[model samples]
Target: MDGNQRETIHKIEKLLVERGLRARTIGSTDFPNVSPMKAVEQLMRQCSGAVILGFPQTVIHQGISKPNTQQEKNITDKQLPTPWNQIEASMAFMIGIPLLIIRQQGIEGGIFDIGTTGHYIHTFNLDNYDWIREPSFLQPFNEWYREVLVNNN
Candidate 1:
């Protein structure tokens, strides 16, 4: 992973810890066969919830170009060999739906799964099975969680 991606993961992990959620980092630079689902299951067993934030390459093999105004045009013009976005989006949806169902059934704690792929931010609300694109949505949710789940009776 690049420096910027590493920094982002670090910051996210810190935030999870501050919010009273147990966080773990599980990835291998050597083994190319690592499955993210396995890590998620392990973390879920140990913590109330788990947040998985991985690089685009981990989920999408295609390389994204540097930020540019004309980038959208360039991307649309090309015939991508693989639909990485669609695949990752589908996987996220699948994972989140089950979590939401469980949460609605009165699960002890909720899950917040977020990822940054290229320039897009993808978030899944395990409590509702809602997919949110804006990162700012987390701010209000976090505040509510602290006030209601953590601080109040």
Candidate 2:
């Protein structure tokens, strides 16, 4: 996770914990030796819900060369990592896990356009990657996740 995403994850963990909900990270204390894909599978098998911080940040997985596809030529701007996180999102949907995307606030802050539709989520990161006592954007987010994770509604 990038620095911003790390902070975001910590905040989410804190929020979830405050509500008496447990939170798990991909690595750090657990699954430190596993591949991200494997960790994803492991988490999916365990957690009933997932949250993706789709903050337009890209984390490129080295050593995996892109195969020759028609779309390869279309992506002229190779700076941004291809949306690899979408795989987890798709898997969450397939597994019937509730999923949401946390984005930044402002014009560029929102759900990513992955070319297909399924109500891809977008919620503001009112913390703005800093420590805030009362992040305004988090209220709606808390409500949504509380329903999904706690109430199962």
Candidate 3:
């Protein structure tokens, strides 16, 4: 996590710990001495659930949608997370692990898009931490945690 999202990440980690779960990340919880793919494979294999945080790592200004196409349209101020988020989320999905997608507000596309995986995408503002305590986050999280509990059995 970068300085921008470090506090948010820590808060989420704390919440997980309070719920008796550990939050693990690639660079933080697991080292990446090996190939990134191999390292992620190893780390995910040991987990029962995955929380894919879609924090904006890239932004596009004054871009085009469907470039060079008949239905092309203008796009602006689009925010996207690292491609790793999609990759890891796909891994967790294929592994049949419970997955929770929490994205910073305004980040969209791929897994962050509604109906992408049919999993609820919980959103929170970068400047506000209140979303963590809201039912919107808690409900899906609780349900996903239930699946995690069931899978462990």
Candidate 4:
């Protein structure tokens, strides 16, 4: 996670820790002594599941959707998370492990889109912590954590 997301990452880490699970990131928990992809693959092999936090890493103030296409439309304030989240999450999916996707409000498309992975996408506002305490988030999260625990054994 970047500096912009440290606090949110911490809160997520705390939640996982409370449930006897530790959240590990590529740069934070494992340094790349080898190629980055190799390191990430190795980590994926060891994981019971993955929680992909889709925090905005890029924003389009004004742009066009499907530029040059007949379906093109004007877009504004479109936020996108680090592409690494999708990459890592896809790796986890390929490994046949459970996945929990939490996306910031307004961050959509790809795996963040509902029904993309069979797992429910929980959306939250970055400006507040309300989602953490809400049942919608907790139910799916706890359910996914249960799968992780089962996989661990």
Candidate 5:
């Protein structure tokens, strides 16, 4: 995981702990093959609640010969499934717990600016989370988390 992801996870864990919720950090290996379903199954078996976060690669199967823009390249139809959507869908399906996907964008001074960098999306249902757009993912999840989970909890 990148520094930004780690920091975000740390903040999330802290909040969970403060709220008297149990939290655990599962390694990337636990999410093998970019399958959100598998990760959710595992997490459900281990914990009553979970927050899965990471960037999963999306493999482009057939599309334009090349990306028309950098953002387009970052998000394209791929042969491989992205873990973010999978996890969101799984969480929404199984427990109705809120799922947040954080998309990190841009690098400045070799450090990710959490303020202007990350994107957040709330998937209360499987269908909506699966249809999440690329640019929408560029919104910072922390802000939304504070508004939704932290504040509400």
Candidate 6:
């Protein structure tokens, strides 16, 4: 996760704790942007599932040191993601970890359709594990976690 998603994720963690689950926020920031992969590796070894809060695809631009031209539609600059959310998510999936995709408003929700063929693939072979956090985010997770993930293991 990037800096923009940190606050929202913290809120999500609060909700998880409210539902009687132990949660931790791990990312590159914790290691000062040097150890996200190491953290993910350790987490893959330790954690049961992952909660990926997906945001709408958007670009960010900041701290530009250039003059804008009218021909460029008054655009000055744009920011690009460094760690890349999809790569991390893909890693968690390929490692066979249970995933709880919490998509923001207007995004589709379900198991990810991976690769060019776009065949639907369940990360942990669990349906009913992801959804949009509109009415409530805890129900599907609580049910799936208790029944499928926890009881199975």
Task: Give the best candidate by lDDT.
Answer: 3
Writing each residue's lDDT as its tens digit, candidate 3 over 27-96 gives 7787878999988887888899999999988888989989899999998898889999999999999888
Stretch of 10 with least lDDT, candidate 3: 1-10
For every candidate in turn, the CA RMSD to the true structure comes to 12.9, 6.0, 1.4, 1.6, 11.9, 9.3
lDDT (10s digit) by residue, model 2, range 53-101: 5554443434333457544433232223225466666777677777665
TM-scores for candidates 1 onward, in order: 0.37, 0.59, 0.93, 0.92, 0.40, 0.50
Instruction: List the global CA lDDT of all models.
Output: 0.36, 0.57, 0.88, 0.86, 0.43, 0.50
Decoy 5 TM-score against native:
0.40
Clashing pairs in 1: none
Better of 2 and 3 by TM-score: 3
Ranked candidates (TM-score, high to low):
3, 4, 2, 6, 5, 1
Query: For candidate 5, lDDT tens digit of each residue in 1-153?
Result: 446445555665665666566564345325445465566566655543335443424445466544676555443443332444454445544554444443322211111123322323322222233222334432433344454454334
Q: Per-residue CA lDDT of candidate 1, range 44-75, in tens?
A: 34433223332333232344545555663322
Q: What is candidate 3's CA lDDT for residue 56?
A: 84
Better of 5 and 6 by lDDT: 6
Which stretches of candidate 4 lie above 4 Å from their native place?
1-4
N/CA/C clash count, model 6: 1
Query: Could you give candidate 6's per-residue lDDT for residues 38-137 as a string of tens digits?
Result: 7766655566666665564554444433447544443334323233345556666776666665544333323333442133222221123233243354
Give the per-residue lDDT digits (tens) of candidate 4, residues 59-152. 9999999999999999999998888888888898999889999888899988899998998988888677666878888888889999998999
